[model samples]
Target: MTWTSYGATCSAPSAGYSASTFASAVQLLAAAQCFSEESLPDSSDQNFAAYDFIIVGAGASGCVLANRLSEIEHWNVLLIEAGGDPPVESSIPGYHFSLHNSDFNWRYKTVNDGRTNQGNQDGCIYWPRGKMVGGSTNINAMMYVQGNSEDYQRWFDAGNTEWTVEDVRRCFRKSENYQDQLLDQDPDIRNHYGHDGPLVINTFNSTERVRGNKLISAYDEIGIKKVKDINVANAFGAAIMTVTASNGERNSMSKAYLVPIKDRKNFSIMKNALVTKVLINDLNQAYGVLVEQNGVTVTIHANIEVILSAGALNTPQILMLSGIGPKEHLESKGIQTIVDLPMVGQNLIDHLLFPITVFSDELTENSEADDEFDNLKYFHNRSGPLAQNVVLDTFAFYATNEDAKYPEFEAYVLRKRKNSSGLKKEFVTLFRFTDHVADSIVELNQNHTLHLFLLSLLHPLSSGTITLSSNNPKDPPLINANYFADDNDLELMVSGIQKLLELLDTEYFKSIGGFLGRTRTPNCDELELGSREYWKCQCLDIVSTVFHPVKTCKMGQLESDSVVSSRLKVHGVENLRVVDGSVMPNHISGNTMAPCVMVAERAAELIKEDYNLY
Candidate 1:
């Protein structure tokens, strides 16, 4: 059928029905049927059965552990998740933002410190974590960035001997199955990645290539040279990112690792299961978990170990609820302390993002018709704007000092079309910007297209903490982001903003008539708009997270400072381990998804060796 005829058919009324309508309607019906048939098995019937290994939180790490540990045919493994299956929108890359504030998201909000983030809604920042099987991978902008080698070097130097740069790289390679077309053209990139793994990694099929390339050129002119592959170059430049997707669909850890072995006799997956506490014995050994599922609470035992892959935030909460946290803090909440590990949730670190937006009159906005056609195009062959991440597939990483081994700043570019429909929703609902700030952005978009440069302080000296709001597991953990707690962090962010402002002077930007757009904030009205002081003011008022929280349950050589050891074993507690981003000693220089996978791969090997499974 012709494309024009299909479009006409989609708009036809009931009385004007034609053969084209039947054809188009049947395609959608068939697609829905296929989606319904693809479902994960709910093994809740076997909830009472004991397991050799019980992994809490079916996130990036937990899913990997479930797949790897269950490989041994004799061992029984249980994977429990707090949320149900991912929705159809999760599979579409461009719909990544649509998952926010939905059932799939944990929808966490940082406690309003009444100091920073004052320009956000309710004077608090929104932190969205994925509650489903793949965890944040289901909601994240699927960037596959294995942080700089020096990041792991610091881990090794800080008494985490098992995490040497070489070992870290090897684990990343083990979990990656790089499928980008560049592999056939570049030997260095080809040799740098694993080719036989289950997780597919490829560049997004971006439809905004012309504008994206122009932005890359602008970045190069500003000293962030365009590299063919940022991964091979150690994240020293700007480039199109590789993503965890295959054939226009998100390849979450659940899709890559769990779906293939859903029917394994030894593997059991329990969905909508909330693990309230780790069941520790009188001797401080975690034997199993107390799970609240289907409105019923049950104790599921584990013969070997109970691993906490419940992410940086939830893992520590679970530990504290089970009486394995700070002695005095547990007592304050009327829980007997089993282990006096004070660092259970002390060292929280996250990458804070500030917007440095620029407006251009030369760019054109996408129309409603264009969006509808793009949706139809995706249903046809999965090839359209809907098949890729929304203008988020490119990135620029740079260091303040030219000789620095790791990047101090990371920039993400997002384009907002002029007079576009979702601008208010994006600024208010997704970003939680205050009414004035959101209105300013929406108003500016009516006249000029916006190029928002979201600059993030990659490694902040300032760290926050996750503490118990109450003794109840159902209560959300109290998150004190404590951003800009260190003066040096704000200084670094201002420096990064100053450097990014140079992009307006680039040839591509100049040709497009680009000019710096100021968001109206009452706190910064007295200062000069483009001055360093004004940028610093904006940093304090407009800051939000990139949702990369780590190091809450830090790993180190001493129990005096850390909650877990080099082998991932919880200090002062036997048969309990933390395998998620919480074990990170420090924040990585880039995104956390890829590094989380690598951490899990290494942990899986460590578990196998300790148990003699191999």
Candidate 2:
């Protein structure tokens, strides 16, 4: 497989091609330049470095904080990232599949306990975290969702009074730079989005493909209303999915927030640098961080604070490693406990998505010649299927059991996880599920498939934990996602699958030749297809993560139930705070990226307010 300036000549992706697939190699090198880290300003010093602020993990939140805090001119900020800059492949919206499990991905796996991942041979699950400048945004689906308003209301209800719906919506608007030029054509939709932030949010024109409109029509036929924008309140219906991209390229955090300010002397980025631990004084004030780079260890001091933004999985790991976690767990690992915050790694919650494959009689232009044309189209004008994401245009958020306060499930019409094919095959080999499920997915990859209905549980009752496997900072954390620990999660998931089947059977879907494909598992052979019992077994068998993990470093008023304060400061430690997805007090209604960015925006304000920067 050779990569060209326009695109690459490679074999079919594991998840197959969708309208969002890359077409050609044109401008590939130029696009790659957009995310390159070589041009970032360097501020490394030969001596021990001290700065106004030291932000750990140059992820979604970290990048935003760095950009915002550094704007004060005199305020020196240092951002450290475990991974390097994203590669050129990271620029293409459709190439996200190839980015996973690669050098750019942390590739963290969970330790299963027989309750979940029962379909896999080893009873384990694969969790991929971004290890690059933009962090997970470098490899995510790039969906731009702000989550339901009530989701934030729950945060306020949990003693977090500052993060009300109005406050969060303000932060959301403040953090976004909506580039949907079409919005100006509609006054109602125009009022729903922000226009002056750095990040660009837009959707592929609905007329660009027939599949997305067909899905929307099917949803409408099923009695679901059509929403003008899913990024605002009342996202309880089908709407065109917006993405975090400008033109056809991925608008990662590093690109959106960091690139414009790369030359600022007050701002410095340390890539490929792993922070070992936060340096705390006898008074429990964070002074700096111990970072390892190129076999050399150095202590970088932060005069103001040490902000932890290493994401949901790694933030708690870093805290625990610094002796700021549970007392008993730290003592057992032979690490001296500095601040015994039991809530540090607890309250782990994530959304689980079950991919329901359907067959369509229509053939998509995914052939070799068409791939070249698509690449050429993207290379020439940044348009066509190559310009979009894997998911189609329509997204539906609905409740299965609860009142319409918040969605119990979110359904998206998209292509398969071509990258997950190999992973699914491994699950089959591990006896995670019988051949009919994983193997069938692998076989269907060779077909001319169109769309997939990925029904994800919006609010799960189950929660898990992230613990230390070893004291070594180089070693990955032991993640116990503990999926489906509560039976209600499975029940809601089964109901969601039934709703998807109903959509497939709609006249609108039938007019487009959409047919439900049977997902058989040996464990459910006795139960009939489409039966609740069969789906329950299937949900337990193949249920996987949607990658929106949060609340591990929970925020609350009490120290016993939370890690960070309502202001985002660590409960007991002074001059230390966690400002990432982990600080979310509850599960969000949609993707976690927008919420994470919103957290960074709020964190910046809180930090500025504390220092009287205004």
Candidate 3:
């Protein structure tokens, strides 16, 4: 089938595509059944007996653990997930945003804090988590960014000695299987990236090349040199982003690690099974788990350990429900506390994004490149705009000021905001914004303006908590991110906005007719557009989450300040561990998925060593 936009239809394929190539693509598509609904293996094929390891969530970390642990023929691993297999839409890169609030998402929202979430309605921000087998990675914008080296160094300095930069890089390399196409361009076959592993990492198709070049040229003109490999230590600059996609399809954890081994005799996966609590005994030893599936309560014993991979939010909740949290709060909720771990749900850190948008007279939504034609092209050849994430093409890391020890700002280029009304919004009565400015933003957004820099604070001093709203496992927990509680975080964000303005003034940006000062930020029209004071006010008003929440069940040396130990074992408990984003001691300088995978990679080795599995 062919598609037309602007009254022009062409059967001619893209530059790299040809009629013979299309024939091969068609064969591959049919062979792989790429668009078919997911068919998860039936757990009944294997007996539901006691297991060597019972992983609580079939997410990024859990899937990795399942694959690695089950490699030993003697060990039996049971992976339980609260959601079913991923849908066809999950494989499409551009449908990342549309997956939110669907049945695939948990759709949890944080409690209203008068301090930050000022722009959100009722002070609450929509926090969407993937409810499917792969967890958040299934719904996330498939960006594959290994965090900066310094971020891992801080973990070592914080008493996590084994998590040094060199050590973690080994773990990253172990999990990565860099695509041959990507390495073909480099020619050196560098040791910096893993050449053989389960996960496939590569760059996007040629459709994004032009937009990436434009963004790189604009940044290069402003003295930010084009960095070919940002994966190296201390490296910075713009380049075509690396992603967790093999070819055009998203290579989620399920696709990369789990599905290939689903039929293994020693491994089993349970879907739509909600684990209520980790069953602990009199000695505070976790021996099993109590789960609710199909409205029936079932208990499964674990012969070895119960690893909680329920993510940053749900992991702590599961622990607290099992009576392993702060003593005072547990008693208040009428639950007896087994351990007085006050730090069970503290130290929550997230990356906050502040958008600076501008109008582009050169571009419009109805331009020759439209969504329908792109979709048609993707269906036919799997090489088009739909194959890449539309949110942004390029990313740059920068230090907010001279005092900073690490880069604090990560500015992303988001060019499309049409159909962006689905984003969170606040009632004007609650947030105090003028109607004219809000209307202006709405009007410009409809006219196909460019969403310039979404300035994200890589490190924020503010922290929040996750508490049980009620003693019910089915009810959502109360979450307060407490964004901008620290003055330094706000200052850093304001600095990032100023840096973006500096980029807009560059010759390359001006040549593209980019002018940011023309449109004033919503509710801040009383002040000058380019002044520092006005930007600071706008920063406060527009601050929102980048959806990178972590550090709630942080890893540390002391029991007083942390829930899990450096080895990922929960303090004061036996055979219980948190193996997901919740165990991060601090927020990493990049996306959390890669780090989550690394944690499981290391955790598996530790478990193997402790049990002498080898």
Q: Give the Cα lDDT of each candidate.
A: 0.85, 0.78, 0.75
Q: Write the per-residue lDDT of candidate 1 for residues 1-614, one digit (tens) a residue.
A: 11223223221111111124433453443234233113478899864668999999999999899999999888899999999877656676767776777778888999998888888888888899999888899889998999998899999999898888998999898888899885536999999999888788998777777777778888999899999888998988998888998667788899888988888999988999999999989887889999998789999999999999999999999999999889999999998898999999998999999988788887565685576566666666766776788765789999879999999988988887788776887788877888888888788889988888888899999999899999999999999999999999998888888888899899998898899887977598678888989988888898999999999999998999999999999998899999999999999989999999999999998989897864
Residue 86 shift from truth in candidate 3, angstroms:
0.7
Q: Cα RMSD (Å) between model 1 and the true structure? A: 5.3
> Candidate 1 — what's its lDDT?
0.85
Total residue pair clashes for candidate 1 = 0
Q: List where candidate 2 sits over 4 angstroms from the true fold.
A: 1-38, 45-48, 205-208, 365-368, 416-436, 442-450
Candidate order, lDDT descending: 1, 2, 3
> What local lDDT score does residue 130 receive in model 3, on the 0 to 100 scale?
87
TM-score of candidate 2 relative to the true fold:
0.91
Best of the two (1, 3) by TM-score: 1
**Which prediction has the highest lDDT against the true structure?**
1
User: Candidate 3 regions off by >4 Å?
Assistant: 1-38, 44-47, 180-184, 187-189, 233-235, 364-369, 402-405, 417-438, 446-448, 517-525
- Give the TM-scores of the predictions, in the order they appear: 0.94, 0.91, 0.89
